[model samples]
Target chain A: MTRDRIGALFFLAVSIAYGLMSLDIRVPPFASEGFTARSLPLALSAAGTLIAFLMLVLPQKDGPGVEPAGRFLAGLGGFDWPRIAGLALNMLAYGFLLTRVGFLVSTILFLIVGYRLLGERRWHVLLLASVPVVVVFWAILTQLLDIFLGSALGRWGQLLAAQFSGGA
Target chain B: MLDGILTGLSTALTPTNLAMVFIGCFAGTFIGMLPGLGPISAIALMIPITYGFDPATGMILMAGVYYGAIFGGSTSSILINAPGVAGTVATSFDGYPMARKGLAGKALAIAAYASFSGGTIAAIFLLIAAPALASVALSFQSPDYFALMVLGLTAVSAFAGRGNFLKAMMMTVVGLMLAMIGSDPVVGMPRLNFGRVDLLDGISFLLLAMATFALSEALMTVLKREKISDAARAATQGRMGSLKLSGAEVKEMAPVVARSSVLGFFIGVLPGAGATIASFLAYGMERNFARGAKKEEFGKGSIRGLAAPETANNAAASGSFVPLLTLGIPGSGTTAVMLGALISYGVDPGPTLFTERPEVFWSVILSMYFGNVILLILNLPLIPYIARLLTLPSNLLVPLVLFFSLIGVYLVSFNNFDIYMMVIVAVVAVMLRLFDYPMAPMILGFILGDLMERNLRRSITLNDGSISFLWERPITLTILVITAVIVALPLVGFFRQRRRLAQAGEGG
Candidate 1:
């Protein structure tokens, strides 16, 4: 399918899912005299569904020409899918590692991996670039802003301490 | 009016506010000179840092960044023929030719002076017009406000690049859906949380903005492999010749600058007609107005050609603030981001803002004057140093951008879940962007969605739940009619095109 078709179908699915979920919104009895919580969501989802349906039927006038279904399926291999996929995975891993390790450790690791994925070759350049960025951000956010950078080991250590104190 | 001006000057002249203005202008210019980052991203990246400041100070900083980015955009356009932002694309027409002729210094200097002139002129106009416009808006009711918000949302379709009206509208509705995720503002009941306790307070606007603008832009750069060429990088080096314009050149360009400034400011006042459109219109008008050899020199390094767009774009940048400050309607994407910032700072930008938060209103306006002066001084002597930023590799910049976004979002709530959500939002935004979907309407919808809903509900309740109340009020009716016409015009054109294509098929 073409990009427009894919987009339309994707939005169509989302609208239906969100519409169904909106049906479960609970309104309070003593609420103000006006539209309830579910009203806007239902209206938005319905409008979205209508627009998405129109998009499916309307012919695309711009961008790359539409090709056969087989070509469309094969087109996946035409672009740099691996790089995109690697970056996405890198972001997910960074998020997971952020809480597991700490801000500084996770940020440096994420940047190094991201640099390699983007075709950076020199290890020194990667370390030199990523480490300073991590340190600067850490200093600004933690010291200046006073936000805590949580770590998995810190949480685990707290849990172990709580268990020992309870046993004692 | 004079009292407000004095109050604004006093507020903007404070040590901290002056420092904020200088920093915001410097950072805006530096970032705007970099490829792939525009004024919108510049503002979005700086938003997290402004959370610790007062509302007036934050507004001043953002206002500085807003116009400062426009000034910086022209540097890349003149030097490398690659516009740093969309608004400066027209600047490259004659600017690059002048650079090839080794008049790069003159071209950069002219652009800086023209921008300063336009910005200062538009600041004067803003001072005169905003208060009057705010007074008019002060009498507005809930229904009128509702109509105005709808009009603002619909007007974005005009700027939605190419023929993606439906796609833009779809993105807008999706934004509205996203805005509904937290507890209902009206009833205090949680909805769309999906049973997550972290979502009860709703998704943070900071996270959404960082994801949509900054993080998504970084990911797209990686996916598309956007890079500045080595040749273009080298072009930015070397001794910049005389930075001074001859007396005659300045005298000749003065009228063009004045004319384009006025034209650009009016265009900027209209919703959805932003700096890009204003610059193009000004450039075209100047070309038509030029006579003799000047007309032939348009694309061949004409000073009038270069100055017209530079002036108009900066003027338009200042003019776009009129609707945002007075009527609570953002005329462009950058202003929409600023609108979100304004709301986040608990400084609602509407007619009442002039009366309620006079300091915020006046200080921001006054700071634009200082910002333009700062940009001129920074751009003239330091063009070479500033141009070096364009050489920074995308590979290094991309990771650093992602790092800032991650830390910015994480710092907001100190919740890892928000970071995860930011990544998700960024992924979704990138996917939509690949399909030519415009991101501006979605943001506009997201920012105004809650207000739109509340006003709508309140209006209906005033009329005892009668929907006809919308059509009964004259202001609401007129605004809605205008909105309908704007929305329907594109659909009408689409159908006409379809019919013509069908006829052509039959003939073929």
Candidate 2:
């Protein structure tokens, strides 16, 4: 299938799934609103399904910048998928580490890994960019803005300190 | 009205607000100059920072960013022939040529002056039109609001350009579906969460905006392996000849600027039509209006060519604010982001904004005047310096952008789920974008979905569960009729064109 046709099929499946799921929305007994929560979702699913169905059945029309006969696999193949995947992994890792480590440590590590993944080789450039940014951002959040940034580890530390001081 | 203006003037002139205008513009320019990062991304990045600010100050800052981003986009277009924003694509046609002719400084100057003129003229029009529209909108009931939202969404799809109607419509429907994911607006009952505590609150607009525009855009840049060419770097560092415009050049651009400013403002007021369209239209209009050698000079370094789009786009930027401020309907993606920010600030934008918090309404308008002036005075000289940002390697830039987008959302809720959810959404957005689907309509649909549903539910309730309210009131009927016409006209044109082609093929 062409790229758009493939997209259409995906959307068609999504619309059907969403439509089925809309049936599960439970309305409370005392909620007397005329339009229930499922009303718009159900309507949107029907509209989505119809549109996707039309897109699938209709003759494939190419928009500007899109070639009519471009294959889905061909379009996806040219992209630098490995690099993108690396970045995604990095982001996911950052998210996992953010709470495990404190904000300062997590953010610095995130920036350094990000820079390295993107092809930065110089140690000075990486450290200068990541460390100062983390420090400044940390100061701004904690000191300047007075907004507290906490981590799981920090909470654990606080708990330990409270217990050591003989407080519950 | 005079009192409102005075209130706006007082708020806008405050030292803190003045500094905000400068800071917003500078930051916006820096960010917008980056390839793949437009005004939407720039403003989305600023949302977390503006969380603690007063509504007027936040808006003033955002408005400045909006104008600055457009200006910054024009700079990249002129210098590198790579339009940083879609709206500046037309600008690169003549602008890059002029820059190649060793008039980069002059081109930048003309763009600044034209943007200033366009923005100022539109601000004046805004000053007049906004109050009138707000008063008219005061009488808007649920049905009228529902119809207006329909008109807005329909117009967005209708104007999604040739071959994109179905795609835009589908994306819009997807947005509506996404909007229904969290808790139901009316009853606060969970619908599509599938029993997750995080899903009960639904999706955060900030997270969605950050994921789709900021993170996805950054990832796309990396995925495409886009980098600033050495030629672009040299152009930035090279000596730009002359920033002064001759008298004849000024006279030539005056009429074009005036005409494009008007065209741009009106087009901007229309739902779905925005700076990109306004710029293209203005460029086309000026080409048609020119005579003899001047007409042929277009796309070959004609002053009028560069000035027309530069002016129209800025005017259109201001023009877009009309729908957002007066009707609470965002006319374009950039304004949709702003509308989300306004809602987050606990200041519902619409008719009541003018009466309830005139400072926010007027100060934003007044700030435009200052924003335009700042672009002319501040950015005109700083172009050479700001243009250097173009040379910043994407390797470093993209990662920083990714970090900011992830951290921006994480800072808001301090929730790890948002980060993971954002990455997932960004990946999906990237996939959808790869298939030639426009993301703007999706964002627009998502932003308007809740409001549209609420109005729709209210209309149905008030009319005793009948949807007759769609045509009952005059305003509602008129808006719906207009929407119908907008959708029909494009499809009619498409079918007619296809038929003509078929007949020709048969005859042949």
Candidate 3:
């Protein structure tokens, strides 16, 4: 019921779920059993879970007697609706525009919206600042040479080629 | 040993290799100097650009960024009392004190020099130790690996814990559990997909890191509503003039440097034991060792105090790599990012890498030494200049970090879906940070989740549901014993303390 304990619980749940999920990881037949890709993390996570469970059982009982700190954390809980909504919208925006608008454009727009949401607010500022950034990033990573930023150029190649042909 | 040094120097002195080290170190320091910035973020941000380099060159850049970031974390701490990341918190203890005493010049010198001592000494240690460790471990079986991980987890709890040792354990355990959500290692069945393709990969460790460390920190700052930039500026008020160490200061620092280097390197060798502990432990050890008139300098601005932790942590930073390069096991969050970087380059870090790929091994080793020198030189003059960057407004710094992180994260997949994921995770990360939940274990969890599950499946399949399987292996038994000791001892101690506290409270 400790807030910090609850915090540990939240992460602990994630560990259990993660460990449980490892049962299904696909490994190439060629991969070795002892030190294969999955083996290292699988062992590591189990240890992580063990460590977390111990945290719950042990008590330092520091400072003044503990009191419920927050409604949600203290178990007087309700959904974190605002955060859930914000996250949902953010995902929706990215999913919708990923291929439709292209990597650079969609990425810039995403960064701007996220910045604005965090209170960046000024469109002129966001545009002036964010655009050059994406361009410089584009120039440094893509134009100069291929650097992996997920695949904006690859996806847009057909559209870009079609335009080039049209212009020629 | 001498031949190794000469060979290392010969390869390191080449124009491209030298330049790469310089670039890596310079980049590392740049990110390190910027408060709230770290190597992982630097790597994630620059991953897009490095993708084009020769794998070794790319690794050099990443290696530079890694060490540089560790070295950089102290700048903000000394320059403004704000720790750039979790690793530098110990550095700030005495660093800020020395700065306030007008001995900032001395403090900067100690940090630069101590960083050098730690980095170079540990690099040497790595050169000597890595080969030995790898050669010995070349024949490990799956059961053995499971045992090793248990050993590493125990070591990690020892290092990552402070006020809440049990909680740290809890955090570690939870981190491990979450890492297990993806496809089963044995048969490839997805356990937590909830029917989403993305879920098949489970949650990405990198995504989790950005969400928890970078994004969460960003959100909490907003919630606090105080302008950190202004406060930071006011706090870091100083000139970065020529940083030099006085003869007396140098003399005092020499022994501290030697001691911390030894201490830092050993601790860093343990997987999951990060620089944070190396520094804190060094600080405690220095205080204990200071028995003379010099003892008074422990907390109130001792250059020795500052030198020890910086050297120790940097050494520890180097030590963390031993496991990574030798065994392919990342010892800390930053190293985890490095592991991801290696993967992106399609390079696996394990015993065979040494024999099969000497260039990758040696070149990276050679680059690290030069990187340390470059960091020292860069940080020496640049500290004051970069200290000014400490004044960035909260609104600006916050936005910039988030922007770059998102860009960095998005570039990871160009899947705006990832960006969206970043934002959502960031918000959750923010909540977690606000509540004082340590983010390191979560990052540790996410990073290790996939592998934990895989090994479990493989082991169970190999053992065929025999409950005695884990206990049967000698290595496994030993590790389990250690884990049992580590886990049990701490829980008992914590409970005793709680009872004592409760009784004392009633008496009072």
Ranking by DockQ: 2, 1, 3
Candidate 3 — which residues are off by over 4 angstroms? Answer: A5-60, A63-65, A70-95, A103-127, A147-168, B1-17, B231-237, B452-472, B498-508
lDDT for residue B361 in candidate 3, whole number 0-100: 70
Docking class of 2: medium
Worst 10 contiguous positions by lDDT, candidate 1 chain B:
B223-232
lDDT of 1 by residue, B1-508 (tens): 7878888899999999999888998888877877667888889888888888898898899988877787778888888877878899999999989998998999999999999999999999999989999999999999999999888888887557666788888888887888899898876788999999999988887788788888887787767666775745778765567898889999999999999999999888888788998999999999999999999999999999999999999999889999999988888888988988898898888998899888888999999999999888865788788788778888888878887788777767877788778888888888788666878778878888888888988888898888887889988999999999989888888889999989999999
Per-residue C-alpha lDDT of model 3 across residues B1-508, encoded as one tens digit per residue: 3554455566667787677777776676666656555666666665655765666777777888877777677877876777766678888888888777776766778888998988899998988998888887787666666666666655566555656555555555556655655565455656445567766776666666666666665555555544546645665574444476668878878888889999999988877777888898898898999988779877788887888889998898888888888877678877777776676678867777676666777777878887888887776777666666656555545656666666566656655567766776666666655555566655655555555454554676688644365788876787678778766776677668878988999999
Which pairs clash in the backbone of model 1?
Answer: none
TM-score for candidate 1, residues paired by index: 0.93
Model number with the top lDDT: 2
lDDT of 2 by residue, B100-119 (tens): 99999999999998999999
Ranking by TM-score: 2, 1, 3
Candidate 1: where is the Cα deviation over 4 Å? A29-34, A62-78, A144-168, B495-508
